[model samples]
Target: MAEEKQKKKGGCLKWGAIIIGVLILFGACAAAMTGGGEDTGDTSSDSNEAETTETATEESTEEETEEATEEVVEEESPDAGIGEQLDVGAMSYTVNEVTTASQVGPSAFPTTANETYVVIDLTVTNNGNEAVTVDSTYFKMIIDGATFDADSAASMSANQNENGEITNSFFLENLNPGSTMSGKIVFDVSQANADNPEKALQVQEGIFGTNSGTINLQ
Candidate 1:
């Protein structure tokens, strides 16, 4: 009976050890699974953050591009009209009147136009401190996207007095500061453009001055 009891006790001890080992293995597997899940979650979070940063950067670049385009469009000013003051470089001009004529000058020494004469009566003020030389080339007529130069011959006749006397004051003329001169600038244009309401004058500071302003002829 003693030996049998001892054998039974040994059998219980063996079974208990096997059950403890199985429990320990199960706990280890559970810990490994939990750690793996945490790693996967951290990786997902990092990828989301990277994507969000990239999206924000793209949006900022697009906004900047749109602002730059708008700036370029606002640089152009509107066109000026008759009797309005326009300044280009150092000269300020005002177109008082615009007329059309087939001929000009005295009857004894008159000059005829090829098509029609578009005359612009204007007053120019020497706004600068220094004197500037003025010429007929300082003015041009714009018609139908084309520019026509002043007709110097007809212009010379137009500048004459009633006695058929012409003065060189309007040619290579020197304008003093604070002084103003009024004259008619003539442009020979086609018959169609002479009556067109879309004509304008491109007035400049000098014959070749890059800075210019436009005056609506109508």
Candidate 2:
């Protein structure tokens, strides 16, 4: 009976050891599974962070490109008239007299005996504060009923003769406020035309001083 009792105790002890080993193995497997799950979660979070950073960088680059394009368009646009604005003022002219005589020299006298000459004294006055320049090339002298060119009249006489139809060029560099300048114009008139000449000599539409003015040559 004692031997049988010993055998029963040994069998109970062996069963207890087997149960303990199974429990240890299950706990180890559970721990490994938990660690693997944690690693996967960390890797997923890192990937999401990288994607967000890339999206933000792309947005910033696109915004910069749009701003640069707008700046270039603004710089190339036209703004306003690119020239100096001229302010014109009032002008007046007066014809003093018309006469036949040479004041420059005797050598300038016309070689032709029938050719006569006349002088027209003009007084041009600027009433405005602005300076004015005139192109006197357009000036023409009218004697009797004939028109004479200004440049050709210069050859009539070497003397300063103010007779006949002639245009005079005077550079009144700057005609300040309320300033006046006097110049003489000579015209070549035939002796026959000068005889009993009703309107012996007259100046017409030869004075265009400025863009703005009622240029009266009377």
Per-candidate Cα lDDT values, in order, are 0.85, 0.52
CA deviation > 4 Å runs, candidate 2: 1-89, 102-114, 143-145, 151-177, 200-218
Error of 1 at 50 (Å): 5.9
State the lDDT at 123 in candidate 2: 64
- Model 2 misses residue 142 by how many Å? 2.7
TM-score of each: 0.72, 0.37
Tens-place lDDT per residue, model 1, 116-213, is 99988888899999998888877888888899999877878888878977764356788999888888789888889999999999888776766787
Error of 1 at 198 (Å): 0.5
Best by TM-score: 1
